[model samples]
Target: MNANVSIQSYGLVAEFDTPGDAMRAASSIRDAGFRKWDVHTPFPVHGLDAAMGIKNSPVGWFTFFGGCTGYTTGMLMIWFMNGFDYKIVVGGKPLFSPFYAFPVCYELTILFAAFATLIGMCFLNRLPRLYHPLLKNRRFAAVTHDKFFVVIETADPKYSPVETRKLLETAGSRHIELIEE
Candidate 1:
């Protein structure tokens, strides 16, 4: 069957009328073992993550480590600059004062964590998508309005347009489209 697939197409998109249906479809897809499927909705849907079998995002770990590194760097910089580099013993105060360096270390920790979080989010989500084949589907526009959708990528090992379409339909999807890459 010449499905007329495209290189840009992530996969097939199936539109459901309601969040309930979409959630059900997502759960079904998850259970069916499609690893690269995603559900799109106008707003975040409760329990959708569980339905998708997604675990807690790893961004938190990135932030935590980034913060730690930042804190260490900040502390080290303060210590080295004041104690060793310049050796400015001002007002008879010790050069490596932990109390004086606390704020900078705290700020640097937050700053690095923030940057890492942004970078991690971008990397994890594959941001700057620029364009998606689903955008070509006029019906997909409703996804941002009141519609919900589930997209199963063709790159999935189990992807079969015919079978996937049937699965979506069975899961209560109404408008199923073969999105090109």
Candidate 2:
């Protein structure tokens, strides 16, 4: 280790004894106009999204468009293969009846929708992250077992160490610590 190396602050993490405490702190932080804060808990907390002011996700729209594209592609491919190209007149049926293409279209729609959902979720959440600063914090390990925590990133423009610490303390955090990057 270099003795002259300077440590950088990743953020401030406030530990709460209960979900309620963490939720309250999160609400206070959100109401304070801090944009880059997050909460971690052992299990899901009801109404946490509302407290955090998180908006509805747009992944559904991706699924919708993917399904539409898949259906259109399936229909067009079938029509081109069976009706226009090969000209297969099976049992005197019509060239391009939707009833015959429905099965393939439905399967393609399902496949594409599922793929879109996975890709959209990964893209939106920025997946494949192999590491995070919080993972290096010993206390944060309790998040997988029992404790709840709220972290406010230093990069947030509204962050002030003194004021943010005071806010967390007022919100009933049991302990607060600066996280090193």
Candidate 3:
């Protein structure tokens, strides 16, 4: 921290001692119609995704489409280059046999699907996020150790700092801090 620098808030974050309390707080916030919020815990908690109203991730869809495209492209490539274009004739074997292209198609399908899954994940998670205001909070450091925290960002149109604080307090947050950017 530099003395000349001024702190700006990114959001209000609440720390809870127990995962149960944190999970409850997440549900409360979701029910309150706040979208720009998240819950962090030291380890995975059961039913938290349902409590937070998280839907299935789109990475699977991306991977499916990518695999379809890869299969089509690979099949067409093999068919055209081998059967239609070059007309490579071997001993008693059809150039356009599906059996011959199976391995190539399978490899390409898996390759494309894997690439799409990785890219989709990165895009959806907003990766390459090198910095965040919450990272500056000392208390937030314990999120990876043994703390359950919920943060509601200022970006939410419905966010009310005073009201949010009251809600968090009601939800059983032991300590709260406004993380500065």
Candidate 4:
């Protein structure tokens, strides 16, 4: 690596003393039409999602589809074997009935639903990320403990260094710093 390599700015991070401050800052950032920004806090904050203008998650849809697939697959498999492929008659009972397949269908529905939820969450979050510039910032480490933070990425079209800094300042940030990549 070259010693004189120039570091690129990742974004601006503002630290707030309380979740309310961070939520307010997030609302302001959201209202400003910034597309790339986030707020971090030690724990979940009530109404913060609304403040950030976040909509409902689509993960539930994935789970629903997966469950439907699983149930359909179970029913079809049972029907193919019992009703179509090789018929078995015992005690004058029907070849296939939904009551008999209910156990397998129910189990598969739960299994596939759980798998889909995990996969959807990972896909939506873009997980398995090995690194992020924010992880290197010492000040940001407080986010996991006591502090709340709002980060506005430089990639956002609405981001202006001076204006963003001023916005954070006005939003009641106790400290603000530029992150580098």
Candidate 5:
């Protein structure tokens, strides 16, 4: 993964052997006005979301949009197909009555909402990324094995590599390194 090396852009990365330290660092970093940051750990840590200031995701908005699209499409399909193309009046009911198409519309809404939730997450997070600059950091392998890491991206406006290192150092971080892009 190291072969395709980019320019050495620097950022602060703090490594901890415990989740507690990682969470503390996350909170402190967030309080310090560092928005471009991420936390990684071997296992899910309780209260980590609060520490990182992560709020409810916007995925619900995606699902809502999908539901709306599905409802409109389903209604249009039923209107055009059943009412205009091939009208059928069963039990002396109105041919284009919306009540008859309610079930199909509801089903399509749920189906599209579910699909949107799944696809929205993947899209927002930019998943299926086979490579990341951080993957080149040898010490990062322990992130999936009982270690915790917090990285502040260099793109952050307040990101001065030296200042970030000092901040992390004061926040009880043990080992810190500069991640190169």
Candidate 6:
């Protein structure tokens, strides 16, 4: 296996011709007690997540954290810069008035959350990764078209190329191939 192309170190990939077959294969793979696998499709397929046993993404938590940071920073900035440091006496209002700072705080909260969501998603997913070992397998191009693919990472304790391929075949995958990472 070439180091540049193999991202997972070892894995078995099974390709399906139709989304229905792919979904069925996913369910079968889950029922077979295998974990550490992923499914790729050309487009969104209903019930695919449930079949793969994937839970909701954790990106929301990251966005929340970003919002919190933004809100706090915005409030502090207004308070120190306008209220305390400059001591603006507009309309005879008291310093550190929450009413005047509400808009800035609200805007900052939204800005930070959006920024965090984008950056967090990229970081968590290891984005900017231009090279993937899976590319070495020319057959994987079908994933962008009408094909569906399921890859079981070799890192899983239960994974073996031969056994995995056989399982995929039994599960009705049309084609099975070894993907080196």
| lDDT scores in order | 0.90, 0.92, 0.90, 0.92, 0.88, 0.86
- Residue 146, candidate 4: alpha-carbon lDDT: 97
Model 4 TM-score is 0.92
Which portions of model 3 show Cα errors greater than 4 Å? 1-7
TM-score of 3: 0.90
Q: Candidates 4 and 6: which is better by lDDT?
A: 4
Better of 3 and 6 by lDDT: 3
Per-prediction count of colliding residue pairs? 3, 0, 1, 0, 0, 3
Residues 35-150, candidate 4, lDDT per residue (tens digit)?
89999899999999999999999999989998998899899999999988999886788899999988999999988888998999999999978999999999899889999989
Q: Which is superior by TM-score, 4 or 5?
A: 4
Give per-residue CA lDDT, model 3, range 1-181, as digits (tens).
6898776578989999999899999999989999999999999999999999888887899899889878887899999999999987888799897888988988899999988888889999998799888888888999999999999998888888899899999999879888877
| Tens-place lDDT digits, model 1, residues 105-181 | 99999999999999989988899689778888899999899999899998999998789889999998778888776
Candidate 6 lDDT over 1-181, as tens digits, reads 7778734456888888888888998998888878888889999999998998888989999899999999999889999998778886778878887888889989999999999999999998999899877778889987897788898888887877677778899879877777766
Q: Candidate 5 on 1-181: residue-level lDDT in tens? A: 7888766775777888788888888899889988888999888899999999999999999999999988887899999998899988778988787898889998999999989989999999998799788899989898978788999988999998688889989888889888777
Q: What C-alpha lDDT does candidate 5 achieve relative to the native structure?
A: 0.88
TM-score (C-alpha) between model 5 and the true structure: 0.89
Model 2 agreement with the true structure over 35-141: per-residue lDDT tens digits: 98999999999999999999999999989988998899899999999989989788989988999999999999988988998998899889968889999999999
Checking candidate 5 for backbone clashes, the offending pairs are none
Looking at model 4, residue 167 earns an lDDT score of 94
